[model samples]
Target chain A: MINNAGPSNSAAVLDEGVGPPSLSRLSDADLSSMLLIRHFEKNLLKLFEQGFLHGTTHTCLGQEYVPVTVTSLLGDADHVFSNHRGHGHYLARYADAEGLLAELLGRAGAVCGGVGGSQHLLRERFLSTGVQGQSLPVAAGVAWNLKRSTPGALACVYTGDGTWGEGVVYEALNITALWELPLLVVTENNGIAQSTPTGQHMAGDVRGRAAAFGIAYERFTDTDVTRLRAALQPLVEQVRHMSRPLVVEFVTHRLGPHSKGDDSRSPAELRAVRAADWALRYAAAHPEQFERIDAEQSRRVEQVVAEVLARPLTDWSPR
Target chain B: MTAPRVANDLNTALHRLFAEDERVILLGEDVCDPYGGAFKVTRGLSTRYPHRVRNTPISEGALVGVAGGLALAGDTAIAEVMFADFVTLAFDQLVNFASKSTAMYGRHLPLRLVVRCPTGGNRGYGPTHSQTPQKHLIGVPGLALYEASPLHDNHTLLTRILDGGVPAVLFEGKVLYGERMFTGGVIDDLYGYDLADGVARIRLHDPVPPDCVLITSGAMVHRTVEALRELLLHDEIVAEVLVVSRLYPVERAPLLSLTGPARRVAVIEESTAGGTWGAEVATALHPHLWGTLASPIRLIHSLDSIIPAAAHLERQVLVQSGTIRHAVKELVHG
Candidate 1:
């Protein structure tokens, strides 16, 4: 298991966030996905402002790379189970940005029949069990079912560092490994779980702990989409062909306080700081591709925002 | 003129089921290897079917959660709780997940699961281990409960529950584990009593007017019947007794139908009196049926505290068969 080893100082090297994939190389589809995540987060904020969105919202502002790339490796037949901060992950797979926006707005067109608001964005192919630390077992079950029924489909579960403390996750990890089930455990190591930083609260390395259970374990920076793809591609392929368990840990900054309920820092200040270096360096690296991708992302977002704003306020049709 | 063949008891019945169906896997703590179980009910199961009997870790919540998922995947998982007291850890999986899965999720998942809870207090295992926690689960809709007192009752109830594909709880009395019944005897064929609707066992007597009725169930029924048999020596208090073998989806029609002109009625239960079947029965019979009454409904129940360990202390706290007999006489004669 991942022992209580002290902070290895490798996190300090992430100051410039180098050695990761450049966003310049991202296809228009990937850029549209990234823009969808941003627009969804903004719309979620608007819903929270108007009192439509209930419960906590865990925006994947900084950690978009993990969902974007991991989902890129998944087919529609494959399944992904995520935690409360599931909007980014869910949309990354399903890509129904308006449906998620409608869900946050509690409209009839919402994916979960408008019953589950911000935290509970569940689609047919991609499922969120509407809980924290609870989806792993169900995901394992889904993986077990898939292994038996559909030989090629893989089940991926995304959990936070906070969920690592739960014994049920360990139980699921053990069972998945023992059964040689095709399960991918994705950990979003945001350095902080809500308020407490993982260095203080999390006992050990998340990936190493999974490795202790004999599951194939790997970790990367959440900003590094290409690197994540490289690491997860083999695992996903193995799940597709070999039926073995896999774990991928994406380490990065939360950039926001866990959810909308937390206002520990100014959102403008955090967004302003993160938006500068990452976007600028990527745009600088490849000018032609960046221009083309930016125009596509802008057009998609404008179209979605216009359509979303023009709709009636009240939901008339039954959910 | 005829004798019934030995249908075999619960343990042997389960052995037959496990042997018959490879999909029927038994899971719980101490179910394999060295320790068969706390009650030894599954003693020879592991030896019989090594791969089928799974001895799980001592995590009740995970055990039930895993069972729920397995059942959702179309596996017949019979999970055992050594003592009913420990079922509290698994109540969420039972009440929230399994019971509500079909209803809340629009029957997308078909949960064919059986939980065997060994309950009751005749042994020296104090308040913690002796509770009949079925009362807590009675309020949960969609799930059925099978409270078995006799060996044959359990066998019939298990088979009936297995045939019906909804979630069911089989509560076995700790005291009745070793009690043997002549399975070869020609017992009353109650195989047709709708498992969803409870069966009402009405012990017949000559010249039965059914003036007063006593309703009871579980281990208390054995004692209540014996005491009622003795009470028949002098007083012709021609009364009918309704034993609720299946606790949930309670056959209320049969209960109301069997009462006849029994104006006065009393209910005896060993579980907590509040929010129990006794309370529900009294509520259902009162108001409308008040005109047929010689007196109001009376209830004989256990004290509000947990059952004590000592047999003497337990008997003092809980209602005995004589207690039901006394209550019936007072209600009819008063």
Candidate 2:
């Protein structure tokens, strides 16, 4: 069992806007996925401005490396449960940029037939719901099933730091630990929940909460996708072999607003958050591959947007 | 077997389910040995299928949510709520998560999950512990609702629901746990009924066009049955009794056929009168039988308030046998 991660630590980290640990270069695949999500979200905000999109969307801008690294370790047999800010999670797993864009535009060929909008997505071995804290138990159940039916497979669920306030998360953690179910709980602790900072909304910390349930807890303060993947490989293997639950907390940053145009932070705080952005670090480490892939993925997203926007609306009707 | 009570029948059904299907999992508070659930419907189930029958903590929402996940992974899960009132604690998982998971995805995910909610208040459990909360779940898409009755077989209902692969809520009447399962012949040695499409229709005196029809379900069934018998014997007003178990997405075809002979109808329920299943049934049946009905279908429900713990006060708050009798008489004459 783990003890308190202590208080005001997140505040110290968030207020300072200290940059993440300096790391080695990332692989082409990892950099491409990170840039792809970056282009997707940046394009979504612009599309909102251009009248091609309506409704609200939560963009995983600076936190793209979290899913891009974690999902690279999952297999087709393993399940992934994503929260509201799940575009990066989906793109990291399947790279269905056109399907996701079509979904956002409610166009034909959209994933989920345009029923599940920006916050909801479904595909093989993956599901996302807009509501917070509801996916934990479902993911635990999937993990329980995997332990029995699939043997070596595991279920990974992504949640925001704010979602820790939901009682269902603790309930799920208790069961996952008690049953020794193969579940990986990934908390993208971007230091804020919607408009509220973590210090105001959460108490103690996620590490203490996971410890209370006798689950193993790990933390990531760096954005090097390759290094994070190397560290996660053994942890994920333990989850499969022992069929025990694990909580991986990524103390990352959110460069964008909680949603479109909802940044309640000041310029100083925003600058602090920018310090944690991996794009600058990735570019600084390997400028050539970073520049080439960024431009390529950016153009790829532009073409995806144009093609998806031109398609007809989906024909799915309610029963 | 004929003398086995509703609880015994349910226990037997669960035993059969566990013996036959290894993938069927049970999760709830104290559902294992020495507890066998709050209603004891899960008695002796865990001893046989130890791995499948589990004792969950007091987390209603997560248990239901987890059950949905298990079912989504090709396992049939039965989640038991200690009492019907606690089902409220699991509303988000049931209504939002499990309900939407069925169709929100591109395709329908066959979620083979059944939440057994032991409901109704006849044991003086009072406000928070006693309630027939099925009305709260009325009309939720992809959520099938059923209730235990003296007329229906638990094994048949559970088997059929699991076979269809739709997520369901089986509202077991806590009051019916000790009552003997009705097999055939005269019910309460009073009336004869026919079972069709999981709905039971009782004719009190003879097969004549009823002057008043009484529609009710679950723990309220016997009360309505006794009321119809009284109406026939004393008032000589032949009445019909339609006891429904499947409460949601009301089957119009079978209901219309079963209710064809009904003239003045009244929907009697225990869960107070306000946007209820009774109201839904009346609305579904009204326009189709508009001019045919002597009057607009009446909804007879308990007084809109919390269930009291005291016996007399509880009686005043809940529907009774006499309550159904008096309501039907008013529907026939008033």
Candidate 3:
């Protein structure tokens, strides 16, 4: 099918959001979850500056609404395959902020016993890999199994626009279409892949790619969780009951660097990205609920940081 | 009744696995009814278990990935990469994802996945079509390497892989498919085999003390046995033949006992020399077999070059029985 939206553009603003959805109407639970990821990511960058963290991390700052809303659409049994920048994906599913921070800090109570670090996290029903383009096939296979073993539960995988270059992505998509596995491939197309922008890397748009395989394609140019969920209710049901594979691409922005201090964008472009942040938009629309919940989530993340830091380092040995 | 062909036995094993369990899935290119498989090892399978056996597009990478995913989701996934040479296309999925998924993810997930590759050269299929790439996947962690030989039962081997519950790569030599199954504990009418140790130990029809042992696997076992038979008859030198199916995680006790009696042993394979499985076996055995009064563990392999399409050149590039005979005669006489 052709793209449900107009000519696909990766950098289209959320002001392109349908129904002009208001942020003030969003439930307090949803607002808290998004802010929890927001402050958690900001704290991680601060940790690196303060010399408290090692290696590197990819924070899903501007793209927090993708996982927050997508995970809400899924049930507990549905497998969530995350990518290198997957802190929001994990937090949205498990809500275990302390364990995730411990994983990054390599502390004793780390989620993966401190072995997976920030990128390669593995919890029950949720997994994240540091590699690109490999998770789609794995998720497709799991979806095939879920179709047989546990009907109605689907497999959802998160990837970036940069991952379209991987041949395995097409390979997985081809069979997923041929076999009709219940798979939801969510692409967080933030316009730029690492430092190279999408236009430089991708030839045609993602909609055409999905059309080539006959997979259902949907695009979101906004961060309206409630409205998006209401709109997606019937489509998500089709993915589960009809055993159809869907590609939901979110045209969002990377408010933070690709990894850590690797933003190659001009200063003007970076300022534009900051201005489009859902946090800033939410503050402008719902000041009372946004200020209270945002501060509370920020304080909660700081407490998690302090508590996870004091713990001893993880000493892991395989059996 | 005629003896079963190697391909038929494998086909039967796949059918049996699908019949025994509802979760067993076979994925491959042209695996379904009309095409069966390139070598017909999966013949008549999709007809019997249509939903369980699937025909995939020409996608080796995703083929292995889907198999790994099915295995991760608690299904016995068996995938076939048409020819062994193409196994290289699925190397990353095999090593990085399928192999690592077992242990790297916080908890243990039993990936009952098997990738079957029709390996080795002799039929003049040329460089890309007839190469043995099993050596590349031999030592990957959490992954097992196996081969199907005329002397072994496919059902037993496939069952063992499933029972172990780890991802495995089973190499089926291209030339071995048409060969008759060496059944009834006898081989080539000149040697007898003992499968007591889960690996075949073939010796003369009657008991005789041997001077050295030739360690080989898969289709190459036939050549090694023929060389040993010739060494006993013409050269008056008796050399034992130890045929291994499970190539990786080499078992020490059985190997030492089989080769220790002769004190002189050589590892033979179809892969080219430099970084071959023969070298790994020789290195692994030398330390334990030290001071046993032998020159050194010998590694007999094909020349380090691409296999050519010409039959004559292929024979020269691959290790022939004469090469094995020469290596053993030198070890015995000198």
Candidate 4:
């Protein structure tokens, strides 16, 4: 059985041979990627607080594992459409950190030429937008094109439980299933939307919602990297082979508030969630590997920050 | 080169485009083989290009969003919105996604998507169905806006837009769909005009020295042509008619050059007077023509009211030949 007690208990559950897989089982590359995302987000939060970054940012502080593991299963040609909370997704796709940072700072050197802030990041195969549920249909459209042009390629859309409330999600799901487009709809149900809890915003279960559209559904309560990779690899393969849409609702928690402005969670709740930080727990369980990876990620983040700071700031004025 | 009706010309354009490029895909509600389209503009397209032309559900947002996605994925897509009013349902996709994608991405996203909207009144489809919503789409940066005119070759225009490598919204006047157009001299031997820089000018009388210039587009071109004939025959007033095809990015040089020594100019359209295309054209022309004008440019348009279903009421509310004639006469005789 999977450890519902959270990431802190994941190591113990694995030692007892009771859970799916443990974070200690992740490859060096996978662990390094997750560490890089975590370090990058932490530094970004500092920059945001220092007023170096304009516009509000939605950080994926605790939800790094979901995107890291999911993106690992995807090939470079495959497309990814993400929602507002998409920093982790961008980093996982190996987007230039300097460009992403420049964009958040509203510089001309931004990936989107400073037009799209933190919420909207677009590479060749990766796209994210500020609007909720909008990317689902966009993913379906991309998947339709992939179905026609690139036979083996697939499209993945990362939405949230709050996005499930949007009517367009259902419309996109229906069309994706009807067309049998190769799409994977990842609902990162981080248990909250802005300030409201998921229960307040979501009606009915996500599994049932997927079932209504006659698509396959999977729920991952614990988003430990190894467990996620193990559960997702075969599913992604099946989706690519079958050329159909699948829903993977990841039930997790946000380590930080929704944005820089909102800090409304109770102290006890915050402490409890922080104690269950997956990376920290994994580090405690395996100290040597965690230290090596963490140090390397920290150095990389520091190097990127220094290099980006040394460059001239991009002009924010319209061309 | 065939002088078919505007609808048939559009069909011919689609047929040719499908045959030429495998990347071109046509999508909309009831645009399949049996249904073709509500206006039959996409007739026989699906039969010819079976998988390329697709019928979609009644979801306007998805239809447009999917078209944007297809374009981003390197396929040229043309989406047909049944009516201009239904374009409201697709504003998020067209304005937010399609228009802004390349700019937001800071790279050319290959968003070669065209949204075809059938606009205007006269068939009495009422307020919901017959609005000229092109005005709402005008000021959006990075979006190209075009209106089909019987005066210009729509086949060539469609081909140019598809090859233009941009996101565009093309408005086809519903009433003008069945109207026939020829290259020259159908109504009069003096109807000699050439399409230059997106503007087509038909002089009412050759070597007669136009007393005034009347500017219009879409179905209004037909009414303005008729009105010009009346003005020349009855009132002996020779006015040059300038029809604009690219509604946005209004090509001012060609229009101002063709206006040529005429002090009075009248701009007419089917949409409401407030913030209409006529207003934009007049605004653009004011500074350039201010010193040379005899009087202020005359902006003639429909009243700021919902288009009614009744024919007489619709006539009163919309710009007809009588209104065009009156507006032109006032501009010339004032």
Candidate 5:
């Protein structure tokens, strides 16, 4: 069962979310999930700096609230395919920190045997392309296959704002809308792709592009994870019941630069905004509960660190 | 003893294979229902097995990508490129993604995915739809390439590619789709011949005296075989003709074995001469079989330019029977 651990009073965030009405409601536990994602990202940055990691990573530091809220809208049978910045989406669903860290470290104990390093991180059935935008078409393919053979499982794809410009994305989107494939496409609008801002790069509106192809569309900001969950709820239910395509334009911010490559890294403005975000606020208000949540998350992260650090280096070489 | 010769059409060739294996699935644009396919190769496949045959919307990237995924998931999928030219649209998916998916992951592709692309020129298909770019996809490590020359073997090769447990590109000659060939005995399915590492010698005339070997593939094979017979001035100067079916894991052993004792050898193709098949064969054969050769390997190929629309100009650009005959004659006399 999915654990519902956030403070219990956040349900109101759903009824009056900024976007359209939501069919699926986010729980207090779902809100706690966002805090967990932020914690995971912090741990990753530390692991990366300490020389315990190899390969590139696209951290979803600012975009954590989207996947946390959106995935909670999906059922168990529903599958998701996310792009390079996928840790948020996968962990919100499977919640396995050890596998993600092991995968990033390129250890044999990693999920994909380190063949898939940081960017190519994966969990049991929740898959990530680890490459930008490449996962979009594959997700469409998975949706087509799932709809044709299994009937109940739904397919979801999480892509970046930069990814919308790729031809393969359009090809798959056109075909997905044409076939009315049962898929939920979430555009993680993090304002910047690597270092290029969306205004300078993306043309027009992402929702309009979907509407031009006759797809149902919705948009929401990331500050309130509960509202984001509510916005995704209706579409998730509609897709499951009707087996049609939907596009969710998530207005989120990248709290960090693209990767460790960015010299400038985080700014004070984002940190100030993040300080007041709902996830941290909820954790603080539920101090009695926060104590339990913090301890558990700490234990989880520690257990993961120990597990990864304790493993011996594998003697394999790439051909 | 042979199935009665029927009108050679792409549909018939596909049907013959569909009747042979249940694993052979047709996935591409208009492959089912109203359209049957852009070229109608999969015309009636959906009528018999609705679950297996699929008609996807115009998603070339997904067509190859999903086929790779399904192959990874254990299904033999025959992905069709409506025209060889459109394959450019899905180039990254095929070369960077599907071709390397198995080898990069350190896993054997249990997927038998055959990309059937209608290649070469004849129809006024113009620049966008009439290019032979199979050479572009050859460098991928895990893929096996095939250019089916005859109509009958196209069906056999499809069956073999799906059964062989390897990803393959089976190029169907747009020129030879409906053509008829009259012969005395049954032509063995080229699939029965090993296509690993080099070329196979298909003889048109017996007792080839082994003066010079004419090596070629695809549509050029038929013309080269015919040229060997028409230009033979004497029984002593025999021209051994080697036709390669697999381009990647090319049938090299047989080609090496055939040219090991020959005094001279020449490689011919319809594609540009220097960088591809001609260059590859010359590079491979020159080192190991250099001492045995009486003359440096000659390459007879089309001029490096866009295939023209004019019939005469097109013929001049492609390797013809006379071109092969002349190359062999020159190599033999050199």
Candidate 6:
């Protein structure tokens, strides 16, 4: 099995690229969304430790750019299907934080009325599932519709390195490519699948597998927000214009364990990953703006949590 | 409208649906012009609406999944699974996703999807090709299960389901597709009535009080009717046959009332004996009808074995007219 070299030096990865965008040039909404996601996940972890939260969550703590950048580029009509590690995607889709928190708390006001917890969040344009690789086929179906009914609309499904092992993903890819549906298959290759590393689960190259089906494939080696925006802007446009499926693989890292109660990584690996946290690096580079955004996001999260906590529990009776 | 063959009626329903709404799209393998469908229900549909009728690949899971997606996106989609047996490949999309999406998740999106499954045995297609899989989906919430019968208007049934804005699985009996349907005919001792709850009941011997109630659905209705005729003419025992159109969310009130003062009730289906639709009916009526019931409810279904391909053995395994007649006799005499 192929082992990941912990986390590479961010400076070396960044120095080779065009310099990071200045604070004014950056999207305030995107930054705030990332901050909110991070803070919300941190709160969830705390609540889980304190025995206040039930079940487990696969937090998108480190890989916030995946949703922040991609969802920002999507229109309200465009659809998104997300995987288990989809908290960031849910928040980025403009779902209210209280509704999400209430869902996790199993309240009637939750998005799914407490039936679907953290993993399954359903909205008009967004749908998330706990089942791995299911989003691809479902997204392909959505894309098939958009291709016929809505001309400019597109469907984007987010998967992980582990989900690539599912055979239905390839089946969906074949149909999407055959029909030339407007679908973007986003794979967040965080080099890990739950406790097991991705290399142990996946065989051969992901890009090569997608290429065999004649799908347009692209790989982003880093989770640099600006670079992601630049790369995806044209690609999303092209997909919408041509109404064809494209596969994009983003190589990133997860700073936290796979889920609650998972502590499989070594201390050195954990420290290395923490040192490479993209949010911390950005904060270290621009401390003043980071502090302001972090404070605002924390307050927003606290207010949402308070509102959710004040709500009554959901009726578990059959509807 | 003149009574047409079941297949012809289905074809006309597709034509009318396509003509009425541009949002109605048809998807399935070989569901195009020249080769309408395995049962010819979708015949000539692709020619009229080339853009709407899609000839999909042999991907049952993907086809159903895509239909769900289309429905979610505010389009009415009817996906035809050539054989009901192949629905196993799409259980996740149908049972888990399409059925549960609207109820478990909020009903933000309208899941107006109709999966047409051509089901039941007797074609000598063997175990894999011929099977009644409606029992597997009857209890799924947010999903309606409908079976087509020649006694009802196929056009009206389909139109009602499509306009209901819900996800439904319609099981079309393979053998019933070619059977002749009667629109209006008055032969002595034969009468037909459509219930408000989407059930079609045919009573043999109009003035005779029903000594027993024979419940069935789909193509089995014809076999039960034949058996009922035999019972009246040969055995001199009159029975009322209640054919359920909407099998799920089973309009229990109408069925219970229709059971009438009969102490003997029998449910005959073409599926297996254990955990079948007949079993559901028996269990649902057992509580209310127990005090009045002279004997236990009889569930007559095919034997618990794989359907054989041989014509002789297939006849023996399936619930034929002879089996129904025998079951009715046993229930009446017991």
List per-prediction Cα lDDT, in the order shown.
0.67, 0.86, 0.86, 0.82, 0.67, 0.82
Poorest lDDT segment (10 consecutive residues) of candidate 4 chain A:
A8-17
Where in model 3 is the C-alpha error above 4 Å?
A1-7, A13-24
Q: What would the per-residue lDDT of candidate 1 be over residues B1-334, giving only the tens digit for each residue?
A: 2322222256676787787766676778887756777767777889988866777667676666666665665667788887889888877667766666545422234566888888877676889887767778875776878777552345566667866777888887776665554233211331111122354444442335666778766556556666566556556666656667677766577777777677878887777777786777787778666888778788877778888888899877766667767777777778
Of candidate 5 chain A, the 10-residue stretch with the lowest lDDT total is: A1-10
For model 4, what is the alpha-carbon lDDT of residue B116?
A: 96
Residue B32's C-alpha lDDT in candidate 2? 97
Query: Candidate 6: misplaced stretches above 4 Å?
Result: A1-25, A107-109, A314-317, B107-109, B185-196
In order, what are the TM-scores of chain A for the candidates?
Answer: 0.85, 0.95, 0.95, 0.90, 0.83, 0.92
Once fitted onto the true fold, the runs of candidate 4 whose alpha carbons sit more than 4 angstroms away are A1-24, A106-110, A315-319, B185-190, B205-207
The best candidate by TM-score is: 2
lDDT of 6 by residue, B99-148 (tens): 77877664434577999999999999998988998888878877888899
> Model 5 off-target regions past 4 Å?
A1-36, A75-77, A121-124, A222-227, A263-278, A315-319, B1-10, B16-24, B30-35, B47-59, B69-75, B122-124, B181-200, B233-236
Best by DockQ: 2
- In what order do the candidates fall by DockQ, top score first? 2, 3, 6, 4, 5, 1
Task: Report the CAPRI category for model 4.
Answer: medium
Chain B, per-candidate TM-score: 0.86, 0.97, 0.97, 0.96, 0.84, 0.95
TM-score of each: 0.81, 0.96, 0.96, 0.93, 0.86, 0.93
Per-residue lDDT over A1-319 for candidate 2, one digit per residue giving the tens place of the 0 to 100 score? 0012344326326433453567677778888888999999999999998988979899999999999889888999999999899999999998899999988899998998888888788898899998899999999999989998899999999999899999999898999999999999999988888888787778788888988998999988777887899999899999999999999999878889999999988887888778657887778878999999999999999999989988999887666
The residue pairs found clashing in candidate 1 are none
lDDT string for model 4 (B94-198, tens) is: 778888786776555557889999999988889899889988888886788899988777768888787777789999999989987656644456566777888
Error of 2 at A132 (Å): 0.6
